[model samples]
Target: MSDIIRRDPRAEWIARNRLHPLHAAMQPAQHSWMGPNGVIRKNVHGVGFIGPNGIKRIDRSGAQQGGATKRTAAVEVQLPLHQVPSPAFYINVVPDMVGGRLSSHDRDLLGLARQLAGSDGAVLAVVFGEHKESAFATAGVDRLLVLEGHEFDGYSPEQRVQGLRAVDQQFNPRHWLLPDSRSGGGELGRRFAASLKERPATRVWQIKGEECIGRAGAGQQDLARPLPRLILAAAECADPISDTRHEVLPVALSTALARSLPRIEDLGAVAVDPAAIPMAEAEFIFSGGNGVKDWALFHQTAAALGATEGASRVAVDDGFMARDRQVGASGTWVTARVYVAVGISGAIQHLQGIGACDKVVAINLDPGCDMIKRADLSVIGESAAILQALIDAVQTYRSGAKRDAA
Candidate 1:
């Protein structure tokens, strides 16, 4: 009996049998407390005994309780859609799109493009080849133009330049925005600008009413100039769009794009150890701190998740991790896409280090910690249990995915 998974039959029966003697005992506890506006009430998360799957399972079908799903639906944020029926002009953006997803740099550029487009113009995104990103609508793209072809795949900058030229000839956008980042965007933007015989703003950080301010003289001075047609913007040039959504309407060129002969041969990605990667360059970071009780388990968890390991200042000082692995203002500042802080209390220095990270997930016992307040997602619980459960979940997902693939 101890080994078998118990069903929530009693809860299920009581939901249907409301007139029974003890129906209320098994019924789901709901939000009956008065809301803010005096007597107003809302039915938010319902309470019941944990089911076999760790959620309340009863006859009620309306309450769906997958852990991830519940968290996302907690606030039910619906950004208002921004649509442009007829655009006066176009502001184009080419994202680095590292790993087939929009980086923080990409989103920031889109936000800048949104500012440039305003209400009259549209923010158009130019994607080379296929991508896995589905959030272009929320990322402030009014029009999405994906130039898909084998010729555009893998280190083919010459081919990509030709594709951009074709877009320019057809759309003749008012502005071209690309990230002045190490991951291909900067070089490509410069190449495209040269093709069009237009001088581009490079390493651009900010834009004023009619002038653009960018770094000059080895980051010693800021160069202000009139806004140019082409811009290679740096990270954090603008905040990403969060208040509204865009149409993301698909667009295509009328004529076939010109093809360029390949000067660079395509080589696939090379494997590197997660430990060998520096925190500054890592995409996913799993960090630990003083609250962690099991160091071995934490290391195992990081490995299972395939994340680069990082540690708080306290953890490094305590000799739990290497000094090189410390993450803070005094340590390495990271711009990881997803930063999971296991037990770190959010120090100001630590927060500053990860300020540029896109998402922060905090797992700790204390819900009121500074880390919890700063985290995009917070899971308040015992670290050991959470880590173990996470490892199991990852294994399950991988196994399921492999089975489906096979």
Candidate 2:
């Protein structure tokens, strides 16, 4: 039409018209083409494309591309039914002036009872004073049997044994769980086990499956009995899982039975130092090691800090401290809020005991020792010199506090 001339304009138009159906048939339904670098490009409907080298990769699904998918069905686990002992008893005899409240040790025994007796099984808690039903119910006990009287005011070994015997005869429980407390539970449990001619595992700390394990001598041991008749559990062994709403059962004691129990002679009690709290229950502990030479200064520092005294195995073996005060794998394990290790060359056994401590402060001659490395704060120095300085600092602080108060 302008400068260009078409020799076959009519023929070209005719050819295009004829080829239209053929081009349509040759083309694919879904569009796909090769990229410039020989990579294949695909449309939205295509799952993947074949590369030039014959490698295939899938495209990201909607779920993987930041879109939420419908949640899958939950899978249910099948739990085996454990057959629990029927009519299990958790006996607790409160001490005089304790207001009939359950101690931590007593609560542990009740917890073991609840664990042994599943949700459906009957777990009865027996007490010898007037107590709130909510207390036992909060500990997951199914029932409470309270025997309240003036005669049951004070704790007596003889009275406890008699009451336990009477209750045993009445209920005839298959299993009896008692607290292995030094106050009175240990004695009661031993005597009861002896009367029944059954050997009980004392101070049990772990109950896995059907086997009960605890510290024995210098190490741990397990007792696997098909059915345990009686168990004296440690306070650290079990924790309470309260879920049951308990029923209160008040058992009235006959005057004859109550009076038949012999009265214990009241002896004046001696006051114990607050710092003499057991290592297991101590909030703060000041421990001495073999390198400590000035024992007097060490003790003075402990007193100033209101800390319980503890010793390493080497110190105990050398007669620097009592064997009972030794803290280690071969000794008593302690759980404290703060533990101060003075002059201790950290051994593996010693570390095991203080493993539960919240904050550990180590003062040793060598900073490369295990205790210093594991400690939250480390002070490298002679033990005796450090102890004296600490004592003096504490005294100055106390004097300043008193002055401020005045």
Candidate 3:
């Protein structure tokens, strides 16, 4: 037996090394085995060593008793700075009703500033209302120029132009980004461009590097080129990235300069229609077409659903809805969360306006219509009946929810 065992390489090696039985146990075994000490052990493929009690489980209570350890420090992301050819300025025109808070479009202007200036270049923001340093800092604005005095309180077109002129004379920014919005931004941009004797590219939707792209003329041709001295960017163009913070240099306005500026007669506050909400700002839009009858009931149903009323070009042309409420290529573009089209035939122009809508619901008598095809959900029925049913269902759900909450 000794001669035969000595001849075997495995037994000879084990004998020569004088290895312990526990050392052999540590090797990957097929299954669990009891050792000399009556301890059952196993070497699992993925799992670490399992003791006699089986796989050791982490005890939550024990861990809680031990308390938490210190967390690792956050790693900072370093971005390379770019050198801009010239300074860029953002014009922030505030309305009194806004309570000094920056609008979404205003924030977009800041985003544009960051895009233009990058990490090193200075980005200036010129505002007419109350200046919030923290807000501009969060927006990555390098400098803040607040226009003070009663003349800058409201949306006075002439007063705003004078304020913009003051900033222009001081900085002489090569690129000026203005909001291309319904809240007097478009009008202001046009007037500013005319005053400066520079053609402003309006409704600009994209800014790649130093170039700006947007729709131009009645045909709405795609216009893309090196950014002009002035640009009126649409709200959808630059999404606000509030991730970075910057130290903003505050600039003091000269009281003498502000006083000496030509002042135009303040057109007293214009009355606002409570029922009318701009399509761009509306969260939910209920649009009607020529196929919709009982226009009054249609509008009432919209009000019941807490949706802003919109209209197809045909409906507006037929005098069923106001021209301002028209949703099409020639009309205001809406980026609502939900858009309900009642009796709308889904013209290409009409569909273009609702392109940004998250969910589209179409109620049309024609099953083969484009609206039905494009809609997330389509209901084939009479427009009037469908709208009334939707209104009733929504009201019932609301009442039920309220009762449950109570």
Candidate 4:
């Protein structure tokens, strides 16, 4: 063999495509690099290679490299902590806390509150019952008040409003902010405003100096009004706080809250067929594509998972699915919490449609497909096999639960 250097285009392409299985092996070794100060910095984790003596050896000259080397530690970036020792006033925020965590809407509401709070005022987050969220500080909350009790759990908007009223009495916040979403925030905000006799700016999307802008009358016209004491903000109202962290200091109401008689009874969620739900409003979607050879298995899996069915343009055009079941930029723009794409090659239009989805799980035989590149999790296999595995796992889990109940 000649001792000449050569470049392999295949290796270069694999290195660039992160979704390729061989991408990791194609990465160049980064043991040392010139620092910003012009000094050579050595990666401690990438120090030495295993020598012939079956021991680790170090060669600063770069000959004895790549042996017994461990992966470099990922650097954790910490934002600056923002503290308010004493606040002149408060900007209280009531978040939906969907699924016991702060959703994107909640973060947007908190961001709006942060802007309203400014320097002298504190951003106070008022949460109902218990929550699993742990990023209140980073979400721009200067103070947190949790109203914990069974009364605040489930569908208890009346109790939630009472708690908010209690917060109003104690804090007398400069402004109150809530997400005007279908997930309870809109109703709760309206009720709270009615209770306080405050005319709130509803569906507000933007807030300038002294005026607020919102959608009104079937969302066909924009309504501008003077910034009010209460606001029901729409989604994407303002960017979420990312630059700085807040104190998240714990606060409490001065007096015990007065409980209001419940007008609504708490009933657990009712199971409904995913087919009846609209694609745009569906929280979980299982979409199929041309690669899906077994349509029956695809439908079975969707039904078992209680997920709304969607299809790529190819599937819809081929008459495997209805036109309304299509999902993409050309079809319905879905903002599902979890979108499962089976055998879909992920056309640009399809990817664009699910842009706002929180998570995308792709099952495809081709690991290098665009769907795999965009997926948060990817399973490289026949879709039928993967669907069967998922169904079996779910059945096993349910059987165990039934046995435990007995």
Candidate 5:
């Protein structure tokens, strides 16, 4: 019989070797001007806001007239380089589709870029097509890079990455910024940083340095060399104060390249797993928000409706709901057959991901809230009352159907 309790000599050696810790004193601690965890410590001199218009949208209305053009291609006519600053901060717009309608996530992306641009950084706002002219105009970004597209050519990730690489190689920015959404923008931004061998940061609420990382190959042998990449995801953080009201900004890429250079082990690209988003199969979904005023009532409402309950990040953050059910840009992006927003103010970041539902019912006391405007059916009332009524209505309908069947 085999010795069941005895371990092999090789197994014992492997386990012991794994447990051996590296010498603490030999490894130098990383130093930063900001706090240990703070990513932004240096003053940003230049920034880049690059938008890759790889896909172009043709005017379907003029399809018969052969007036077809790519949407992403229109970047050329919109943002001329001379209009931009010597080393302007760049902002790129990434387009998205939700629920058969164009989503407003790109607006949020522009908003983030605009906020970054408002600092002492020259802003270069890039657009894919004429669609974003108004968005940039409203955001008040003056300089633009608008690249025109071929009629059939659409947004390509590799192409955008190359365009960004070209600009960064020349300008060398201090801070590179982009949205953290799924539709190619986030991927391209990070890939550009990796291709440039700079630290690629994402979900970044804020940044101030050009330090990035790049990788050549896999495994210990490859890591033995000086790896040149740093990818950051910057979606989670408390709000920070931004002062863009007074100062004229510098170029994003140029300043980043000039400053914020740190000596450290080359941190590889922060890998982001493709979000395995599960589509909501339910016909009706009940979602609550911080505005519910009563967390218990929110749960009661969901239970009463026999509907799955979902909460906004605020509710989840405050311990009202499980983090698993939180819905927003940083949370689960859900698409249900029917979606009901309860006591939720439809913020652009939150609404962009969910607007794809076939039917939307909003229950809120605030008639002025944007959710009311976007909902297919808006019930201007308290969530508790509205939820109770809905539950009752559903129960009654079920009973009637059962009776008819009998």
Candidate 6:
């Protein structure tokens, strides 16, 4: 029945088994290439997405600018992760104000996820919040696990850590990804790395290898494990220029430094407060800037306000105000309900620190500056005159209230 003619015994055997004559003479292919169990194998891995802010639709086009605060996350299929034949991916769902809405930062993260997903595993999502009509109904996830609780509301660093640790324990993922934000992402990333004794690169925009080594021997790199996790914290703003010869070079340097060290430690818990950011619990905020003119004006303004007066670094250099209360990137990060910026040009470096406030009032002679643009209210005048008037007004208001109560 078979198209074969028997000659010598070995020749007949080779002919019957469909083996090439030269290969048979040398060695058998199955014994050399096949596994002991006659099967080829590869390890499976998982990637996790920890979204604290969550996804929301922010309309930055300036046309009726508004967006709903909701949390939505998505995963994409692509390179190494997806291509690995049996990999898994998960999304850590924290309360996201911006749901499903892709900001420039979100798109960058998503792009990386998709590029790395190549057929290795299925991407899954774990959402935390009340179930909605269409919460985890995205295309990427193979299955969605919805966790419900009030702890998901707002940004709780401790709660997030617990949730992520739980996910990692259950899923056993090789990589854990975090989106960089002002709130608490960086601190969490560093803490996780330090706690696990694992090497984590934050603000990572791309990944090169997802290979596994097996087991680390002395300096031989950790193998036996799947692969190194890539954590990306894409910057919402563009990178600062690294030029020192220009006029704005100092500001550029300051911006670069801020980017390099964005994480602010919990100064209270730490024994030594190196950053020297003023405590937010100050009753009186005596702030100074270019407007104070000189050191005498600084004291005069502080006395007039009956508050702690401070100055900008420029003021400090010009011998106008003290080193403390200099609120900017290099200076302290203040959170006073009432913040006054006198005689100061609102540089981007300065604004980043104070922008998160209840209300901000600007007092500047040059009304066209950026400070005026970002302030809640702008008073166009000299700092000395305004300070006197404000002091009088505050005193009168307090006296009137006391009298009325009597």
Q: Specify the highest-lDDT model's number.
A: 4
Cα deviation of 45, candidate 3, in Å = 39
Estimate the lDDT of model 6: 0.48
Candidate 2 lDDT over 118-170, as tens digits, reads 54456656677666435654555555566656665555666666777777777
Candidate models: Cα lDDT each: 0.85, 0.66, 0.68, 0.85, 0.50, 0.48
Model 3 lDDT per residue over 229-306, tens place: 888887546545434555556776564455545466666777544257788778688899978987877977887877
Q: Residue 242 CA error for candidate 6 (Å)?
A: 24
Q: Pick the candidate with the highest TM-score.
A: 4
What TM-score quantifies how close candidate 6 is to the native fold?
A: 0.36
Please give, for residues 1-406, the per-residue lDDT of candidate 5 as tens digits.
9767875675555444422332221233332233212333322211221222222223343434765653364453332221333434444333332232223344444444454544344544444434422334443344545433431024455555555665556544444555555655567667767677765444444334333222223311211222123222232211221212212232233322122222333344463321223324343567888678876766666666656677777878888877877766677666565787888888766685575455788888877666876798999887777666767887899899999999
Give the poorly placed runs of model 6, Cα more than 4 Å off.
1-159, 166-175, 179-184, 190-199, 203-227, 230-287, 293-310, 323-340, 346-361, 373-406
Candidate 5 accuracy as lDDT: 0.50
The candidate 4 region of ten consecutive residues with least summed lDDT is: 49-58
The lDDT-based order of candidates, best leading, equals: 4, 1, 3, 2, 5, 6
The predicted structure with the larger lDDT, 2 or 5, is 2
Per residue, candidate 4 scores C-alpha lDDT tens digits across 1-406 of: 9999999999899997867787866777767654322235344334363321133434444345646654344645456678899999999999998878888778878878888888788999999988999989888899999999999988998898889998999889999999998989999999999999999999998899899999888877889999999999987777577667788999998999887689899888898989999999998999999999999999999988989999999999999999999998899988788899999998878987887677899999988887897899999998889999999998999999999999
Single out the weakest 10-residue window by summed lDDT for candidate 3.
44-53
> What tens-digit string does per-residue lDDT give for candidate 1 at 92-192?
99999888899888987998898898889999999998899999998889999999999987888899999999899899999999999888999999999
Q: How many clashing pairs in candidate 1?
A: 0
User: How many clashes in each structure?
Assistant: 0, 0, 0, 2, 68, 29
Model 6, range 252-362, lDDT digits (tens) per residue? Answer: 111111112223333333333222434344434556677765456556656656554555677777765566657766776664555777887777657755643445788
TM-score of candidate 2 versus the correct structure, residues matched by position: 0.45
Error of 3 at 147 (Å): 0.7
Better of 5 and 6 by TM-score: 5
Off by over 4 Å in 5: 1-120, 130-133, 151-155, 169-172, 206-233, 236-406
